[model samples]
Target: MKKTYVLDTNVLLQDPQAIFTFDEHEVVIPAIVLEEVDSKKRNMDELGRNARETSRIIDRFREAGELYKGVPLPNGGKFRIELNHRSFSKLEEIFLERTNDNRILAVALNLHLEAKKENKEVVLVSKDILMRVKADALGLKAEDFLNERAVQEDSIYDGFQEWEVGEEQLNEFYREGRLQIPEDKKKMVYPNEFIVMKNSINPSQSALGIVRSNQQVIEKCWYQEENAWGISPRNAQQIMAFELLFRQDIQLITMVGKAGTGKTLLALATGLMQVEDLGLYKKMLVARPIVPLGNDIGYLPGEKEEKLKPWMQPIYDNLEFLFDVKKSEDLDKILSGIGSIQVEALTYIRGRSIPEQLIFIDEAQNLTKHEVKTILTRVGEGSKVILLGDPQQIDHPYLDEFNNGLIHVVEKFKDYSLSGHVKLLKGERSSLAQLSADLL
Candidate 1:
């Protein structure tokens, strides 16, 4: 049945095109939401950009028809600005504060009351957890906006699938370096998705390889060497990641894992291998989103590079381990001397064309879908981009494990031959680190 979905401000900020996603349902944007969007339209960050985008989108819809009354959406739904329900008829006693959230709640409550007379349903959609809770307390149906979420509980894509096969088929895969997938099993796998063919009888027997060309064939893993730049794959998942990273054909690779899972280290090693060792690219461009954990220390007083030093320390630590640099000055000297390999700050990475480079984006879970799109769109010809992050460690208030950019890329590009993803398990940083990742 068709229902009314009143959008919260954060929902539109998280995804500017959110209005069109409520297929065949009423999409109501509270007048307060417009005010909130207007206030953010002039800032210099992604939120500002989204605010402007939302404004333009709503304005374009206005050109078709009056938004105050209701405009017909292409998805066979109604879109409108709820200017009439701004009164505090429902929330006067409960949520006395006239804050934006309460105002939105009041609007949704008024709409819900009105809809009941017509036997309709009104749902308030928000990205904010507390807002949803309060809306529920106010006796309004609430939902989290799910249009941009890439991962679902219990069904997160791990980039690999296990297929039970006959012993003969498994042996054939190992012998011929490839196995032809039967028509019945082909639909289970996507292109470039890794498949583990285990003997149906022998649970101990398995051959790991990647699906290719519409899951018609499974090719053997690509990496022949044991180590890249003195770093070896600690387990099978890392090996799979190495295969994807080393493959020149796979231009985009996403590595998602926990804290000590070595996602960043592996990307850096492969990037160095391709850029410095093999000269496959002109430069190795390493970067990460500058998301601070816990309480922020405010701004630092220094030049751009100095200011970025703390935020990029984790990247440096991995690089130091890879290079065996004992002194910070020595590391700096080495980085400066090797002009071909550079650690870039994501803050300055915008609007720049990066060509013929091996790109590694760490802490990518903090990025929004739009931010990820912007970064990936900047990748020029002859470049390979690796996005590495743990979705569980997202620091952005508006992002979660389900909706962050890394997982978004992993889910969106899995079917494409140009992209490959591996969710690395078994952290190899140390026993203590692994324990902390698992327990703490």
Candidate 2:
């Protein structure tokens, strides 16, 4: 059965390649969607980039045939553009407002009626929850655009697992600091995944190890009580994070946790230590997406660094806490003395190859998978990149816990030996803050 899918403006903006995702199914684009996309094309952000890309994709299809009539897509389905001159009388009866959403709905309604004559199904694909609700109220089938969702929230990889083992095996693991995973458990572990081997008879006897899939063994974790830049791990997950962060073998590390779980602090501390103390890298580069909390305050008045001060204040705060500098003047002196740390916005990180640097991208949950790909591809030789964020605190309109770039990288790289991930569960900031995070 051939189904007709009417796409909302957000679907294309969220993913420019969405039109190709529906294999062998008719994809309908409303004229109102093009208007909305055009309105965002002039903005200077990810939305604007996606809007332009969407236009390019649509334009490329013009060589095949007229979009208004229909064009044969590569997937054996048809691509169409529905003009808004159609009658909206049916939709006006339900939704009186003349908003763009209503106009898009009117296009879908017209398509639905025409498809019903041929006994075909017409579905609306959108990322807007309210739009889907209104679509169902109008007796239309609607679904979220989930082609890029790689993992579900509940099924996300926690980077660690527990296995029951014989007492002899457990004791051997503790003594030798390495144990071969039984053939039955080999399929259950991933490269760099943490494991807790407990004695089957005595559950209290356990040993922690990380899977070395290439070596076919589980080795002891590289966790010591030593501090990195005056910051020490306070929990089991934090210890695992340090093991991943300070390792030269791991090129990519992702830390997911709540606000107070020390994700950014630990990353910054380790980056400073690696670049400054150990001279492992040339510099420590920190960057983050500029997604504002509420409405943006518009442009500021200053040069690049001065303009970035407000957005990078949180990064500076973490540095100040690490440096133990209270006065702004003193903090400037200390940072100047170090002369190897550079904090910039994610916008400027594109199109530049960064070599021999320790890069920390905070607030990565606010980025899309495409944006993260761009950032990662810029890493040159001998460079290590760390992405840290709280998936629960995303500010991106189109991103969620499962689809954000941080989680996307974590899940995609779990099987690779050069990547490591840790999800911090406990909040060690303060009792009050922990309670607020739990209750609120």
Candidate 3:
């Protein structure tokens, strides 16, 4: 049966194209949602951009028909902007305040009551978890806008898999440097997926290999035990990360791990090695999202670089370690001496085509899928991009472990040969930190 989906302002801001997602179902945008969207349009961030896009989308629909009445969508659904002129007396008894959320909920509640008279299903779609809870409290159906969710947390690809094989096959793999996976196992593997081949009878005997999807074969990793810059892989996952990071064949590399998994350290070390030692790229560009904890960078009193220092301090710390500079002055001197490295904010990366550069985007979990797409599209010819993040440490309000851009790119590019991903399980920061990460 057809149902009505009431869209919350956050749903539109999270995805501007959310209006078209509910196929053949009525999509209602409350007037208060438009007011909320308009309030954010003047801001200077991704939310403002999305707010404007939402307005433009509605305006395009307005050109076709009266949006207040209803506009016929191409997908056989009707799009309408609802104005709730009804009295808030009932809501006041429950909420006791006429807040924006309560007003939006009023619109959905009114629709639900009207739909009930006609025996029609009505649901409120929102990205706000609390709003959904409120809608449910009011005896209305509510759901999350889930079109952007690429995978569930448990079902997310872990970048590596173990395959049991005969001891002879494992020996043949070591001898010939390649092994043909059986048809059943090949069906389960993806391109560039890390594979640990273990002897069927002896679990201790294992060899690490990567799947070549096109060839239907598993090949040995080239950079096993290899050091990038002065940093050596401390674990098998890090070894896989180093191989993916150093390989010119893989243009994109994504690393997901906890706080102490050396996500940024490995990327910076490999980026320095590629840009300075091997001269593989003309410059090394390191950028990260400026998601602040309390105050934004704009509130800080300093120039752009100085304002970004605190947010970018983690990047500087890794660079200082990689360059072996202990003091602040020495670190500045070393960074100035190496003119090939550029550390900037992700905001400054827009409207520029970066070519012949090795780009490292740190704290990638804090970015939306759209933001990540914009950054990736900025990569010019002969440039390689590495995204480093711990999904569990996401600061972005609308992003989570499964839906963040880091995992989105990891999942989307899993089947492609040009991209590689590694999820580091070990926390090499310290024993205390590792224990805390595990226990906490």
Candidate 4:
């Protein structure tokens, strides 16, 4: 049976090509969806970029057929814009407050009624929680645009593990500085897990084990260069980070952290130390989305780098600390030497192949899953891609803590040896920085 999907404005704004995602199912773009897109066409951030892209996509079809009528999709589906005449009538009664939410809901309700006549399923997709609630009240099937559920913010994993070891085992590990495990530690252990050993009888001999993925056997070379930026791998979170950074096997590292947790700083320091200092990689590259939190950078005069300086300043700050450059001019010299360290926007990253570089994407939490994949696919051989960001502080309105690319990458790649993740907990920025992060 074919399903009919009615997209809200938020859905299109979140992903302009969502019409093609249904995979042979009919997609309905309520007329109001276009109105919302047109209203935001002048936006300068992700929302506006999506609006213009959606307009172009719809315009391509308009050239072939009438948009109000129906156009055949390339992937065995039909797309149409539903103009709700009856919804316009009921708008006053249901949408007495004249809110945008009400108007969008009216479009869905109108589609639901028409779907009932044909005995077809009509599903409305949106990111707004309240819109789905309204659809449920109207007895219509509605869901989040991304089809991703939210995980409790507190329940987000810190990537740490604790284990109670035998008293003799603790003695052996502490005395010999390492211990071998004979049995499988599956349920009690996670891939790339960091374990803290507490003696069942003796408490003073507590030790740590950075578990290797795919097996439980303790390797001899497990604890090399554990201190990263003065933070040791004493807990699971730090161990997870070590597993990603120190390994020659994994090519991708994705980490999530709240404010003051050192996601960007750690990634930059590790990349610089490994690439330039340690001679592990040839060059270091850092990039981020320049999307504004509350405002947009519209029509800025001068070149791209100057316009991008405001957002890329954070990257330079990390580079300054890594190079130990006290003076501003000294840091500029380093940046100039490594022309390989390209500070680029996500837009320019598309349709390019990058090879043999340690690429760090700061503030990755603001990007959508599609955008992240686009950037990742650009990576060539002998390269490591590190994504670091806090999903909670995401500037993109359409994305949330779960559905954003940062979390999606972490969850999807936890099982793969080619990827690793660490959820940093301790904030080492400063006393005041930690307090503000906790209190505010």
Candidate 5:
């Protein structure tokens, strides 16, 4: 049976075209949602962009007929906007104030009554847990907006296991620098599971193995360096990050970190080494969202690149520090080498197929799942895409730790044979940097 879904304001703000996601199911937009959108239209940011886009979408439907009555959508659903005051008949006595949250709840309560009268299942979908609670108090069927949130975080496995192996097994693996187990041995491993082989007799020798398949031990490397780029992978959790970044087979890598984890430096250096030394990829492409962390770049003047100069400066600083170049012009020449390195913005990334290249997306925590999908689908053969950002320091206000696309991809891909992850523990920046991170 086709169900009716009443969308909350936060749902639309999270994704402007969320209505198109529900196939063949009737989508209802309350009038309060429009008012909220209008209020956000003047503001600048992702929310503002979504608000304007939502307005355009609603106006297109208005061409067919009034929003009060349902209009047919391109995909197989009907879209309608509700503005009736009678929706609050039951709750007006208690919620007489015109507060935005109360008004939205009123619209949802009204929809629930109408759906009951017509004997149709009506559910109000929202990202706001409080809104869902309010609907439940009013005796309405309500649920969370699943399109933006993760399935569950409690069950997120780290893709590794610990076991004890015989002394003979350890010597065999060390001599060969790899281990191949029987088909029955596969039962003990997950897709990307890592095994730490501790000597059954000596109790000292141990080796980490990343299970690529039934018998194959995926390529593994060990870094004796205490920390690289102000980050250290110490425990099993940190080891995952090191294994993923050093592997040549797993071409695409995405890492989510807080401020001082050194994600950007690691990604940049890996891209450089891959493109320049290893000859694995043809070129290195570095790009970011151009989203301001604290201040806007609009006040700056000149052409597009000039306007972006301030925002892109941090990336250039990383490159300059990596290459040990002091002059700005010298660094530009290095980047211009037969297009060895291309620093770009997301605006030009669309509609371009990237092949034989290493692409690094810094600050990926701000991107939505749909946007991340678009970027990943554009990757051509022999290309690697690395997304590096911190889930805690997300510049986008709407994106939380679990809900961001970077985390979602990491969680979803942990079970895949081709994917691996690491959470950096020790910060190598400096004593001051580490202390600041802890305090601030």
Candidate 6:
């Protein structure tokens, strides 16, 4: 049966093109939602850009016909501006306040009452968890906007799989430097994905390999036999991470792990080796989004680099360890002396062509899908981008574990040979830190 979808303001703000996603269904935009979107249109951020785009989409649709009534959408759905269902009589007794959320709920509630008379379904769509709960309490159908999610929470690809094989086959693989997987197993693997071949009889005996684009063969992993800028892989996952981080053919890589899994450190180490040691790239640029506790960087005092010192401190710590700068001012002298190494905020990354650079975007889990797309589009020819983040630690209000930019790119680019990802398990920071990451 066909149903009506009532989208909340947050949904449009997250994705401006959401109107065309629903196929052959009725899409209603409440007047209150328009009011909320208009209020956010002046702010200069992703939300503001989305708000402006949403208004422009609505206005462009208005040229077709009267939007207050109904207009034909290209996706075979009808779009309308809900004007009559703003009454608050039913919600005032329980919700008590006439806030924006309550007003949006009132519109949905009134629509539900009308739809019940016709024996049709009216669903309220939102990204806010509390809004869905409140809608359920009011006996109205509610759902989360899931078009942005590439995979379910449990079904997310972690880029590592274990295959059980006989000891002879494992030995043959080690001898020949390649192994042909079973047909059933080959169907489940992706290009550039890491595979751990474990002995069927002896679980302790295992060999690590990576799946090539063919998906039927597992090739030997490119482990860091030599130290990468004084840092070596401590575990199997880090070993897999090193291959993806250092490979020149793979232009895009993503590493997901806990807080202390050395994701950032490994990325910095590999970047330094390639940019400074081998001179494969002309420069090394590290950038991260400014989203965390407390105020933004504008509230702080000093020059651009001085203002970024607090956010870029972790990058400096990794550099300090890699460079073996014993003196307090040693790292500073190296940074000032080296022209190839650069660090900056992700806010200024827009509208520039970054060429011949090794780019690392740390704490990338804080970025949204559009933000990630913007940053990636800025990469010019002969540039590599590495996104490192812990999905468990997210600070963005609109993003979560499954929908953030880091996991989004990981899932979308898994099939292509140009991108590779690995989710680090064992934390190599310290015993206490590992325990806290697991327990907390």
Candidate with best lDDT: 6
Query: Per-residue lDDT for 233-328 in model 4, tens only?
Result: 544455557657777777988888777777777677667667766788777778888663323344676687777778788888877777778987
**Tens digits of per-residue lDDT for model 6, 274-300:** 988899999999987887312247868
Off by over 4 Å in 2: 84-87, 152-154, 213-215, 292-298
lDDT of 6 at 346: 84
State which candidate, 4 or 6, has the greater TM-score. Answer: 6
lDDT against the true structure, per candidate, is 0.86, 0.87, 0.87, 0.75, 0.74, 0.89
Of the candidates numbered 1 and 3, which has the greater TM-score value?
Answer: 3
lDDT of 2 by residue, 175-224 (tens): 89899888877888888888877889989988878888583899988764
C-alpha RMSD between model 6 and the true structure: 2.2
Against the correct fold, how does model 4 do in TM-score? 0.77
RMSD values for the candidates in order, in angstroms, are 2.9, 2.2, 2.0, 4.9, 5.4, 2.2
As for candidate 5, its clashing pairs are 230-428, 230-429, 241-422, 257-390
Tens-digit lDDT track of model 5 for 107-217: 778777777887888888888788788788888888876666665643434445667788887777778767776566766555656677789777677877667654356
lDDT of prediction 3: 0.87
Number of the candidate with higher TM-score, 4 or 5: 4
Weakest 10 consecutive residues, lDDT, candidate 6?
A: 291-300
Clashes of each: 0, 0, 0, 1, 4, 0
Tell me how candidate 2 scores on lDDT. 0.87
Q: Which residue pairs of candidate 1 clash? A: none
lDDT over C-alpha atoms for residue 375 of model 4: 79
Query: Any runs in candidate 3 off by more than 4 Å, and if so which?
Result: 85-87, 152-154, 213-215, 292-298
How many clashing pairs does model 5 include?
4
Candidate 1 per-residue C-alpha lDDT over 135-184 given as tens digits, one digit per residue, 9 for 90 to 100: 89978899998877785563678999888899998888888999988888
